[model samples]
Target: MASDYWDRYFRRARRMRTSRRRFLLGSATVGIGAAGLGLVGCGDDDEEEPTATSEPGETPDPTATSEPGETPDPTATARPEETPQPTATATEAPPDTSAVPTDGSYYSQVGEPFVGITLDIHRGVSGIAGGVEGSAYSGLIRFDDIPAPTFRGDLARHLPEQPDAVTYIFDLRDDVVWHDKAPTNGRPFTMDDVRWNLDRQLTRTLADGTVADDFTLTNTVFTHIDSLDYVNDETISFTLKQPRGTWLESLAFAGFMDQGVAEQIESDPDVISADRIVGTGGYMFTEFVPDGRRIAERHPNWHLRQAGEEVQYFDALALLDVGADVNAVRIALEQKQVDWIGGRFQRQAYAPEFMQAIQDANSDIERLDVPALNANRALIYSWEIGPFSNPMIRQAFYLALDRQLVLQQDFAGEGRITGPLPWAFTDWALSEEEILQQPGYALNKDDDLQEARQLWEAGGGEDLEDNIELVANEPDAVRLSEWFTAMMNGNLGTDKIEVKGIPGGSILPYLTGEDPIAFLTPVSAWTSPDPRQRLARSYTTAGSINFGKYSNPGMDDLFDQAAATLDRDEAISAMKDIQRLAMTESGAGTILMAAATGRFLKWPYLKMEFNPWRLPVDERSWIDQSDPTFSGRPSL
Candidate 1:
């Protein structure tokens, strides 16, 4: 079946070559679309890294009128039972909306109230849109209609290309509907939403795992010192204290929720359930049956727009998560049991066969291969060990391994092995010389053997045979580890090395100082563009995700500096310095670079954009799947 898909993909590709102009670039910027939707930020804490959002402001509105599913009377007055007692009439303060359009028709002309989509989420949401529960609500006020991180320095209207500074202000939309139709429920999501969500993350503790990064809240440099105040009945003001270059990006974060919406969910969880979910997105939850199937339909009152003309493309979306396995996905696609493949199924495991089968079966069916922004497979060493604790021994190990042989034999030559940074991220990548300068980056086999022999002799004697353990998670890592052990044993003698390959998840317990040593450990990323995440997590004792518990103050300070400064160049420099320190000094762990191996069946209509460093949620870069014209069909 997989072979069939690949055959179809090649045929489609050959056909497309005759006329199609748009080539799959393999990489694109997601900051724009993500920022425009105001959908930035880590969706959950336990699962991802801390990235920026447009603004650390407001929860999504939960009021039936403000949300997509329901509409409400803008003029309707709420009874006391409907909303919590007003602390004060914020509307009395009076906000300025002179710059905003007064005409109600402008809002209506925006077209269809909603479009629905079904996404096969690999994991479950933490129940918080941003920080508050599913119930917080508000209407689209004056929204920053641009993508993330683009409006950096201008103070202009609409979406500034670049702002003179990082400050952006928005006015709340009027007549917006929420999921629940209640007006008095916390004043229809005002400036209070912005302030409340940030405060909740900083102060509250819920069973949900979606907590804000400790640094974003406590670190003075990364903090948002913005002021929020209601301007009028249908308006509010947001002013940032400092130049937050990624203000729009920050706004899209998972942590920012509206105050009013959160209060509703906190008050009544019954208002929302597993199947009856709510959000301001184009889709509304119709039903979810755990491992069975989940469905969502277009909301009648959602605010949406078409790309060319002003109309919604999708009438509704049906997301089905049959299973995580690629074989299962192939079966479903064959049976036409699903509309399209969900994100979870988009992995290297699909192999050439799986994609080929799909292509061969249907001409209308195309693949959406979006190379994710992340270093998929990394070779991480444990620095707090017997042999690896020494920089010389670590370097010797790095130098001795044959990457070319390993890539061909173990990974079937499909994998790419380079330095610490993945190959796709060439911009911030360090050169071979720079990599070699790092403590253990050198892989000079002959020289390294001589050095290892010298070190063993210097430490004690040539008769030494210390049984050492080599550990990794995947079959490839196991194969590579075995080959490496053989090389070490053959070169340095049998008494020196013993190799063991454990499954990825099982390696955790031993990594936490249980075993005296390990190598090529796997750790998931929280977010990208934050250098401190990789640095501190792997090198510092305080790192929550640090599996090796490798500690070095020199590397720690570099991580701090990179994290402290907002300057991109300065951060880049700091990261390079840390990379050097880790590789050379064995500060945290020496990386023999990272490798990612995968095969995707290419189709004419199917486009691939890889972001090897981005969060998993952003993999939407595949096949412009969102385009209505796509239909898994190639353009003439």
Candidate 2:
């Protein structure tokens, strides 16, 4: 089947030559239409990393989305009073729209919402569009779709062209539609909308000349672009200020914004919730009950189609925000009140007992226990301000962190140590053996600990204020933070650093504000396959979430060179240099931590073809109503 798809893909490439989006590009660069998609597996984390199944030189198998059945109003679909494990029943009725659609509904933990009036979707969390990283958004191309990282065009017609190191040309897709809602009213998505959105990301100022706060959350991705030009309504091009390795891949991070949304935000600023969402995604915002329930019904007139039929299988999608209680989430899954659970990067959210029950039941619940490589990241300090500004202190802290211990205890010893890029992106990230030899990652830490104390003493960190604050983005991280503190205090001094458990909602502001709290380890869900783009987003001086404001000109230059260099070896060398500079040598800003493999639970009814990052719940997902494991699902 994979061979047949690639055969068709190559044949299609041959046919598309000198026509439409495939025009004039090399055969290797041409993209297949929506009909063919390469199979991909993904990691559930705040940051994105590609997981390739291929061996050293073998081409991995490809998978395709089955044609979508067609896709309504969201009532919360309150959890039906769960019956005992032996049987299941629904006391309350499912809303009308949900019942009408045969495609299954998916449920997962969407962390708290961002509270500002503006939508900070660029930062991965929105005021209303809870974790809009890949959902509730559309970019020029579906460039970063995980597991495979194939360049399946979304808004743009196909893969783009780099006429030179600093220029990119693209042909726009003609069939595009905004969700049928107010402000947008099912308007055709056009080049004007593209310009409007990119302008905000490229510049800090809005149309009214007022400072754009959350709208500019992704400025770092576009810092290279000096200008953008619309070559008629069908085409567009970008002129970069300088050559950048991440220039092409970085576009995936820019989810297009609607003109109406901008105007609406500019006027009231307070109404930018999920209810105000006007996306080009298959799902449209239907209901949003703060901290409670949120849902999106399908767009009947969705533009992306296969064989003239809408592509999304689910008629409506519900994101259940049942808070931190593991037993409650487990019970919801056990009784079949919700279709799935244990995602949104909080792997620890699903209790071990729940997984044991699934395994012990001997039923095909369709679960995957995979490695979570990307989420294994460390906290960056406010280098521009306090104690962390000292490289000696930063290196000492990095050296003192016991990543292997954390992996063994908290993560159950499932994953491996990570550097700038996680282990998932096999194509580029440094090898584990190479990483183990680094200063802080050595197996024997006795020398490392002595060196850490010496560095701490030499840097005058011993004279600093007591209890340096360490903030974590979510609850699971609180434990990691505590462990870090204990390790540091035990290694350096009796009382050195303090742990602060910050809620996801307020952490962004805490990190991005005028006076950000000391240190933070955010769960950044970066889904791009390229390493340069990751560095551009979090490591660059203009990074969207360079919370600690750590900057290194040499590393920045290396990133640009890596992006612009076409030779794979040259690009990879530049990449390693960037990682070593930021993660190891100078600017010891980022501390690479351990990646934990986790188990994702889903009902057999959900025909999920691949391991989705955030369930990127898309057109491919359908329901197998007759699957035996779906036996006792609640009646509508």
Q: Write the per-residue lDDT of candidate 1 for residues 254-334, one digit (tens) a residue.
A: 233334444555445444333334444433445444334344443345333211212222333333555556677666555
Model 2 Cα lDDT, one tens digit per residue, 135-215? 566778753234334445678776777777677888888888887787788788988888777766667566578765544
TM-score of each: 0.61, 0.69
Question: Clashing residue pairs, candidate 2?
Answer: 39-63, 46-524, 46-525, 47-524, 47-525, 47-526, 48-526, 48-527, 245-563, 245-564
Candidate 2 regions with alpha-carbon error over 4 angstroms? 1-137, 181-187, 190-211, 272-275, 306-310, 321-324, 345-348, 353-363, 373-400, 446-527, 536-553, 566-569, 582-587, 609-614
* Candidate 2 global TM-score: 0.69
lDDT of 1 at 424: 29
